[model samples]
Target: MPIANQNLFNQSRSFYLVSILELWQRFSYYGLQCILPLYFVWQLELTLADAFRLFSTYVALAFGFISVGRWLGEQILGIKRTLLLGSLLMMAGYVLLVLSTHKNGLIYFGLATISVGNGLFKTNPVALLSDIYNRTRFTLYHTLACLGSITAIILTPWVAHHYDWNIAFSLGVFGMFLVIIHLIFGKHYLNQYGTLTDQQPVSLKVGLLVSAIITAAIVFSSFLLHHQTAAPWILVVLFIANILFYWQKLINLKSAMRRKMMIVFILLLMVFVFFTLYLQIPTSLNFFAIHHVSHQVMGISFLPEQFQALNPIWIVITAPMLAALYNRLGNYLPIPHKLAIGMVLCSSSFLVLPWGATFSDSSGFISAHWLILSYALHSIGHPSISALGLIIVNRMVPAELKNFTTSMCFFTFAAAALTAGKVATQTIAPLYANSPYISLALYSEWFMKIGIVTAVIAVLMVISAPLIHRVMQSNQP
Candidate 1:
C-alpha cells in the first residue's frame, strides 16, 4: 500500500479499536446503572430518597474523576497504560459488587472503585480519537456507545430476573475483561497516538503524585457515598472551580480560539441542563415506569429496566441518518441551531408524558407506548446536543487542551448527574411519599414543569444562534 493509504487504514483501524473498547466499557457501566436503582430499592431496602441520593452520588463521582483521569493520561501513565489500569480497576470493582451479595457493605466500596475506574477510562478514548479523525466520525462512535448501552440495558434486567444479581454484575466484569484484553492486543495499532506521556520515565515524585491523587479520589468518593447531602454542595464548589479554570484558559487563548472556547463554555452549561433532564430516565423515569407505566405490550411483559433500552435503540436507528443528514447540510445547520432543536425535542419528550398519563387505564397504569414515545423523542434529541457538543469542544480547543476540555465536558455531566439526583429526590421522591394516590399526577406535573422550562431554554438558544454562530466562525479562513 502507498504511504497515504496505509496511514488511512491505520487510522480507521485505530478508530475501530477505540470504538469497540468504548462499547464494552459502556456495556459494563450502563448494565450496572440499569440495575442499581432497583437494587437499592429492593435488595438493599432503601427508601426512594436514599436510593436517588446514592445513585446520583455514584454517578457524579464517576464522571467527576474524568479530570483526574485526563491528567493521568496526559502527565503520568499516558493513554494506553491509563486505559489498561482503568479497565483492570473496573473489573475488580465488578468483582467486589458480585461479592456484595454476601456482604452488602461491599457495594459502596464497589461503587467507589467503579467511579474512579470510569473517570480514568471514559475521556481518554475520545481524546485519542480526536487526534486520529475529524468531528464527522464522532456520531458513529456515539452510536456504538449507545449500542453498548442498549445491549446492557436489555440483558442486565433479564439476567437479574432469571439468574442472580451477582451473575448480572459479573457480566460487567466480563465486559471489562474484554476491554483489557482488547487494549493489550490493540496497543500496537495505537502506538502512533496518545503516547507522549509514556515516553517519560516515571520518576518517584511523579509516581507519588499519581498515587496521592488516586487515593484522594477513592477516599473522597467514599465520603460522598456516605454523606449524600454533601454531593450537591461539593458539586457547587467544583462548578465554581471549573469556571475559574476555564476563565484563566480563555484569557490565554488566541482570538479565534478564545471565541470558540467561550462558545464551548456556554454549550457546556447547556450540556449540564440537557443531561440533568436526560438522566431522569435512569432515576425518576425508571421509578415512574416501575410504578405507573404498564409493563405489558402485545401480551409480553417487559422489565422496567428493559424500557431504558429504548433510548439507545432509538439512537442506534437515528444516529446514522442524522450523521448523513448533517454531512449533507454541511455548515447550513450550525451547532447552536442543532442544540436548540435538541432542547425542543427533549422538552416535547417530557411534555408528552403528562398528556400520556391522562390516558391511563383503570389500574392507573399508562400505556407502555407512552414511555416508548418519550424515549424516542429523547434519543433523537441526544446527538444534536450531547454528541455535537463533544465534537465542538474537541475541535475548538488547541491540541494541548483537548484532553482537559474533554474532561471538562464530563465534569459538566458529573454536575448534571448530581443535579438530576437532587431533582428526583426533591420532585419525585416527595410525591411518592406524600401523595401516594396522586403520585402519578404529581409526577406528571413535575414533568410538565421541566418540559416548559426546557422549551423556554430552547427558544433562548434559537434567539442566540446568530451571535454564537458568528462568534464561532469569526477570524476563520
Candidate 2:
C-alpha cells in the first residue's frame, strides 16, 4: 500500500510539473504567435503580406532551433546545462521584446531569444517527462504536458486583456525562473537525459557544421525575403547541407534502430500528419474566430487572436476527466481506441467550425460570444488526442533511446507547427485580399473541406485501431 501511495505521489508530482511548465511555455509562445500579426499590422502599420511572412518565418525558426537544441543537448551538452542555457536565452529574449521600441530591431532580438530558448526548453521537457514515468503511467503524465498547453490557450486572452502583451510575456520568464527551482532540487529524477553507454555520440565537428548550416539558412532566408537582397545560391547550399545531414543519418540508420525502433519512426511520421492537423488551432483558427464566429463578449471574443486560448483552457478542464476515462477503460479498450477517439474529436471540431461560421461573420468586427462557444469545444477535443499520443510514443519506445526517440516525436510537432503557420500564411492571404477578413462563407467552405478529409482519415484510423491495439499488447514485455 505504501509503495502504491509513493507511486501515486511521484506520478502526481510529475504531472503537476509537466502541466505547469508547459502552461508557462505555451502561454509565452502562443501569446506571441496570437498577438504578433496584429501588433505588426495595427501598431507598426505593416502590410498583411509582410506581417504574415515575418510571423511564419519566426515560427519556422522556432521549430528549426528545436531540432538544433535537441541534437546538441543529447550529444554534447547535458540536459541540465542545456535547459539552464535555454531559460537564460528565453528570458533575455522576453526582456528585449518588452523594451523593444522600434518595430524593426525589436522583432529580431525577440526572435533570437525565443528561437534559442525554446530549443532548450521544448526538447528537454518531454525527455524529462519520460524519465519520470513508467510505461502504463505514460498517458496520464503526458496528459499533464498537453493540459499545460491547453491551459496556456485558455488564459491567454484573459491575460492579454488584463495586461499588455509585454506583461503577459513576462509571466513566461517567471515560469522559466520557476523551473530553476526544480532543476536544483529535483536533479535526481532526470535519469533519462544522458545517452546510453553502448551507443556512440555523433561527432562534434559534424554537430557544429549542422548548427552553422541552420543558422546560415535562417539568416539568408530572412535577409533575402525582408531586404530583397538575394545572394547567389545561398538556399542551394543550405538545402544541400540539410540533404547531406539526412543522407548521413540514412547511412547510420541500420545501427540507429537496434531496439524497438520502428515504432519511433512510424509514430514520428504518423504524428507529423496528425499534429499538422491539430497545430492549426493557432494559425487557421485565428481567421476562423475573427471572421466566421457570430458574437464577442468581455475582453474575450471569438476573434482569431482570441481563439488560440481555447485549446489550452479546454485541455486543463478535460485532461483529468479524460485521463480518468482512459484509466477506467484501459482494461476494456486498447490505447489505439483512445488515439482513434482523439482523431475523431479533432476532425469533429472542424465540422463544428463550419456550423458556427454559418451563424455569423464575426469577421466584420461583430461580437464573439457564439464563436467562443465553438472555441470552447475545440479546446476540449485536444487533451484526449495529446494524452493518447504520449501513450503511443512512450510505450513503444525503449528507455535507452528516450531523448533521441522523443526528438523524432518533437520534430513531428515542430514540423506540424511550422506547417500550420505556413499553410495559414499562404491560404489566408488571398482570402484577406478578397474579403478583408475571413468571411463567414469562406470560413464555412474551408472547414467543410478540411472536416471531410479529416473525417475520412479518422474512419481509417478507427478501422486500424484494433491492429495498433494488438501490436501494443503483443509488444508488451
How would you encode candidate 2's per-residue C-alpha lDDT over 148-256 as one tens digit per residue? 4555545555566676766656665665666666665755544334445213444678658745754664454446435421222332354346445534544544443
Task: Give the lDDT of residue 411 in candidate 1.
Answer: 75
lDDT of each: 0.85, 0.58
Candidate 2 residue runs with Cα over 4 Å from true position = 1-23, 129-267, 294-304, 361-381, 394-405, 426-438, 472-477
Best by TM-score: 1
Q: Report the poorest 10 consecutive residues by lDDT, candidate 1.
A: 1-10
For candidate 1, write residues 134-250 as lDDT tens digits: 776777788877788989999999999999999999999999999999999888778777758866677888778877877787778878797888888988887888789888988
Question: Model 1 shows how many backbone clashes?
Answer: 0
Query: What is the Cα-based TM-score of model 1?
Result: 0.91
lDDT of model 1 at residue 136? 64
* Full-model lDDT, candidate 2: 0.58
